[model samples]
Target: MSVSTPMLVTFVVYILGMVLIGFIAWRSTKSFDDYILGGRSLGSVVTALSAGASDMSGWLLMGLPGAIFLSGISESWIAIGLIIGAWLNWRIVAGRLRVQTEHHDNALTLPDFFSSRFEDNSKLLRVISAVVILIFFTIYCASGVVAGARLFESTFGMDYQTALWAGAAATILYTLVGGFLAVSWTDTVQASLMIFALILTPIIVIVAVGGLDDSLAVIRAKSLENLDMLKGLNFVAVISLLGWGLGYFGQPHILARFMAADSHHTIRSARRIGMIWMILCLGGAVAVGFFGIAYFENHPDQAAGVSQNGERIFIELARILFNPWIAGILLSAILAAVMSTLSCQLLVCSSALTEDLYKGFLRKNASQKELVWVGRLMVLVIALIAIALAANPENRVLGLVSYAWAGFGAAFGPVVLFGVCWKRMTRNGALAGMVIGALTVLLWKDYGYAELYEIIPGFAFASIAIVVFSLLGRGPSEAAQQRFAAAEAQYQSK
Candidate 1:
């Protein structure tokens, strides 16, 4: 559908509005706390919405919807796995981390948390964490870039390379100015926009399909198992996809919110808000995708002629169900999801370089000003590298993202979980966790079940490394043990 001038104006307005909110976030940021974690005082709303937004983003808008559109009901299992995983992640990780990170040497980065928690010397854990963050995040960030490219290609008819650059630019600009505070606050707003668009799209699509009965009939007629949540997909794929939640335990960008939180106690409220937002937004994205399949099945002529590309379901629904203004808003919501995640990943990457490597190793006495500049410069470098790598015609976004997610899960997930809960977590165990976990996933090579039993193998090895290595080896020195005791969760101020 060639949109008229009015629709074009609507699109421009939404873009301007998003840029405006990003600027607002940048102006308010001051300290590294603000830059990194929104001052650890993010209210319940911002905390919940921002976390949900950062987590969902392109995955929901493009990935989840595409899954449903292509596979039918089988795709819903991914959602079920995600919902259970996310709820557990927040319930289990958020509160403890909020208290534990601060108690353990004021960790602002994941590397900081790991090194301080395990009482490791020579900054091995820091080095490991930084490498993982840089490597996997580059791939994860590319996924967002791909989504941006999708938007430009579908709606504005831009060339793929131009679209990729545009996506990177939008994310870089916002993150460069506001940092994490800007990313989180703007995430709150973007999350709201995403939720709204998700709601509007499915509702309109269902209506256009003559309501639920008709929509269901259309889906049923096609015999697409992609719509049913509990059917069609194999057990391993379901486990592999849902296992993404395991990565949350180790994700610095997600956990940074916990550290920046004012109090661990506050997370109880954050949990309630974050879970509800995730479920509703995710549910709607699924519906939009499934409903689009039904709508398009009945009117194939109206489609944008890219059925295999399930990601287009939402955008095509917008052009079909709504006028230009509403379509613009919905499109912006998708961009918001993409940009929110890209900004967070870029910021976290910068922090790993600035805190974990630069100041930790080279410039222990560096001023906050110098540290911040280093961070900003690293962001540019990282973005440029990701852009160059992602621009290659063959770079696979969703697959690469899963490996990064799996790397974090297998590499750090078990270590972080055990490090927090178990007092005797030894340095050898921490090293083992980092090494075994990362290598298992890398070696598994993402081939299939034989490749580490499809995600479980890597996670299992990671868990084993900590337990077996710590138990079998001698414990740390008296000084190191005392350090761990001092930083244990009990040491945090109430």
Candidate 2:
């Protein structure tokens, strides 16, 4: 199918509008601090929406709905797991990390925070953590690129290679120009678009199938098993699905939002707003896929695109059910999803390289102007690497996302949780947990151990390692203990 004039116009307008915002944000980005983290100036609303939008990525709209359309309601366990995980992260980690990061010499990045928190003069912690971030985030960014290419390919009938570069260009440009401020500001808009599409598309899908009752009837006629959430799921399978929640704790993009908030007090309001947005969006995504079964069953002739790739269910439904103009807006939400997350991931990777590696080792006294430019350069370098990885055109968005998600979750989750809550946690404990957690994920994923999600073992072993190593080692130094006490006191006051 060829792109309609309405869709082409809408796409052009949306892309241009985002670039405009980037230029606006560029005016405010004066230093490396603003470029990497908006100078820690985000309020509750931007904090809430940016975190939610970046966390959902293209997986929320495409990969997730496709899983349900392919496997039935059983796939929603991942959604359930995510909701639990997100809430816990906000409640347990958000304010504390915000306070702690500031208290620890006003650290600018996660590795910076960890090294300062541990007083690691050796900078070993910084190097190791930064490497893990670069490794997993490169793969994560590739997933975003693949998602954007898929959208352009499906909608415009463009060849995969052309779509790959074309799709990624807008996001890379805005992120390179505007940096964190641009990404956060655009994320607010993109999050609004994503929720609007997810909510509206499912409602229209339900009505198109004659109503909720009739839709369920059609689905029942097609396959009674589709209604059973546990139809084919075993104990291990269920645990694996639920384990997705663990990944939330360690995701750098999401954590960056927390670190950027204007005040810890804002986290309470942000949590409320963020959770409501998350639950509604997730419910709508599940509805689209589940109700999509009935719609496709009723209209088999229009099912070819979805039949070829179940991930295209939301895209096909939007085009077929809505007016051309409205459909264009709805489809743009997918672009919004892809760009919102990709831009953030690119920035985070750039930060890891510029702040953790280059500034830490090679140029400790680099000027802020030089650092900001270096960060922009790093964005382009990482984007090019991600584009190359996405060149294959065979990668599944969810598959790539899941691997990176688990890598971050296992490697960093235990360390972050322990570091924040337990001042007794020595630097060796963090190092042990980080290494053990990351290694477990890599080894388990490679060996196909127990058919379990790698995060479960990775998190469990990492947590255990932290406790054992910390206990066996000498206590934290007096200065490290004093810094932890001050941060803890501030958090308690909040």
Alpha carbon lDDT at 107, candidate 2: 89
The RMSD of every model to the true structure, in order and in angstroms, is: 2.6, 1.6
lDDT of each: 0.78, 0.93
Task: Kindly report which residue pairs in candidate 2 clash with one another.
Answer: none
Which digits, one per residue and each the tens of the lDDT, describe model 2 over residues 316-376? 9999999988999999999999999999999999999999999999999999999999999
Instruction: Write model 1 residue lDDT over 4-27, tens digit each, in one string.
Output: 455557656656666676688767
Give the clash count for each candidate. Answer: 10, 0
Model 2: weakest 10-residue lDDT segment is 393-402
Q: What ranges in model 2 sit over 4 Å off?
A: 1-3, 395-401
